[model samples]
Target: MTGLGWVGQVLTVEITGFAHGGLGVARHDGRVVFVRGALPDERVTARVVDDRKAAFCHAELVEVLTPSVHRIDPVCPAAAAGAGCCDLSFVTGSHGRELKSRALADQLRRIGGVDWEGVVEPIGSSDTDAPQVGWRTRVRLAVDADGRLGYHRHGSDEVIAQTDCAQPVAGLTDGLAGLGGLRPGTELVVSIDDAVGDAAPARQIVQIAAPSRGRGRQRRRPRTGPPRVIEGGPTTLRRVGERMWQVPVTGFWQAHRDAALVYSDVVTGWASTGAEVAVGWDLYGGVGVLAGALRDAGVAQVWTAEGDATATAVAVNSFADDSGVHPVTGSTETVVTGLPRPGVVVADPPRSGAGRAVVAAICAAGPDTVIHVGCDPAALARDLRLFAEHGYRVRDIRGFDAFPLTHHVEAIAVLNRDR
Candidate 1:
């Protein structure tokens, strides 16, 4: 397939294709161009939008001359608007999940090289089923010159704004489109979803910051840190639960919506069930969100340890509203050392995975089972091998496509210590 570049050819052609990020491959400029809004077996008038040195150009579908058998008209308002979500333009709901499964399997093989020992199964949770309905209860939007609230353009500094979206949570459509009084030139951070409902089981939490702060920009600092609004500024939202959050922006929380339930379900299920006394040591625990979930599921005693003072404060408040979870605040490693040995140990470290000392510490703690939930597969694999060397053999492994449409997958491994 090398050197087959057709830069200017627009000939009628039919070919099989795949749906990856709203893109399907076609010969453009004598090379492959991943086209938007194009389906398999569809003839289209396309134009090259991006060209890579590797002969892969990004194409835009101008017209569909012939559509594919699998082609289905997307109902999402943002699908073809070309400015909202990055992919899933022509995908059916079921097909979207399947594509997610396939992508996860392929990534494990190609990236982590972990085999059949790996269980690629659908995680049962409130979030796994989120993609179907308007599960996105929150969003941050930018205001265009026309006072429209939408997302920013892909690479440009401009915001191509819109008033409504199809995938927003139930009341978010009205919330976003109804931001009534704003200074003419002022930008806004709009909040939506179920924050108003404290008793709704299906509640959601959504936030859209105004003056639309640029991505990669620091969540605007409080002159004295959040809990304190700046003299003239935006609301800061720090999420504590699905629909519960304290707005003060600089607060840290997991970025994805589907992450909490998936992480909680995997960790809770892996903690040996129906046991009277299963003690869990949650290392690198962020505000004890995971530990609280396990506690709700019947773990006898959960000793959650974390490093952040502010997050620990939030954790304390979170558990104070509940019961059974004890928050231990300190460095993740130092906190692990002071805890009593337990039957189960779960660690969800940041992107670098568990460090060398942390891995050794997990081994030192010597639980009957070590459940490692990590964001990076390579780093996770490294620690998994370390645990194997120290007698924590990986018996069952599972992965969750927490970050949909991206290369990120959350893999949790259950290791059984030698009896």
Candidate 2:
């Protein structure tokens, strides 16, 4: 079919492979069709939902003629109903990890020009019988027209109201019912910090943000202010290893319960390659988590730069007892230029993956060791390719199934400058 004729057409195709973003790859009429709710080696009838591109199209699974053995009932009821919380929840945890591993390897080879033969390791418990639930400590929901809290539908702005989402830890969403007079189309961010020993009591915070107003059909108004805390205090306590940080509720933190600890441990191991390293840089550091890890590795001085001023203030206050740690508030690309020369650099940039300029800047600094962390596979691959161009060779790389039951994977790459 040609032009818009493929839109709304139904075709039965064999899902031969998996694609990024939790899609199955199929071909019909010499064009690639990305089908949702299908798995590899499965035969399914799908309806094309979008055909904007000439080379590829998007389709929704209508019926499964054959299913893979790895397919299972989704633990989340909302996910079964097309909610966006858990796109890969229909598959077993092992299968999910395998798919993520393959996707990462594909991106690395195709985009980064590096071959990968690594697996995406699971974070918590290895028991096969254990259900992957109650791992998310943070969740964000959108308000529908009737002022009900729900997640956005997959690939759409429509809200799927659900109270029993299986991803969040218990008591995280308990305050949703108590919230009164919520505005429609607003966003609700709920975060819970479970108490550890005598450190502090369990705390949950709920913050609401007004919907962005658009001047036209395509232009959205920039956010003028931060989200307002409605239920709890402005900040929540997060404990990674023995260190605890007071992070703003609206600030960035790992959603999985064990993600911070796992990433921190990896960073510490890779960053402690040399003894008596003088200075280290933590770019896009949120609340100085990795900076503390650097300190644990015996780095004499550490500079952490973040754009969010609120998070930076928290980092400043949290690291006050340690004079060796410094928090700078500015964009990573700009602040990196003014930082001191470093023996090591740890960059945990946002999903965009520290584009070309930041990578070039880091390369120019000539750090002996650089640890790059990325949440998106494609962006990470592109950034890795950039590092290759700068003469930084990848020494080691690891992938973590941080976001279980989802297609998202966290990867860390340790690179060293060639002599």
| Model 2 stretches astray by more than 4 angstroms | 1-4, 128-131, 175-179, 198-201, 211-228
- Going through the candidates in the order shown, the clash numbers are 19, 0
The stretch of ten residues in a row with the least summed lDDT in candidate 2 is 213-222
Candidate 2 has a TM-score of 0.94
Q: What does the lDDT read for residue 119 in candidate 2? A: 94
Worst 10 residues of 1 by lDDT: 224-233
Q: How well does model 1 score by local distance difference test?
A: 0.59
The numbered model that scores best in lDDT is 2
Candidate 2 residues 226-322, lDDT tens each? 6767766877789888788888776789988888888888989988876799999999998999999999999999999999898888889888899
| C-alpha TM-scores of all predictions | 0.67, 0.94
Best candidate according to TM-score? 2
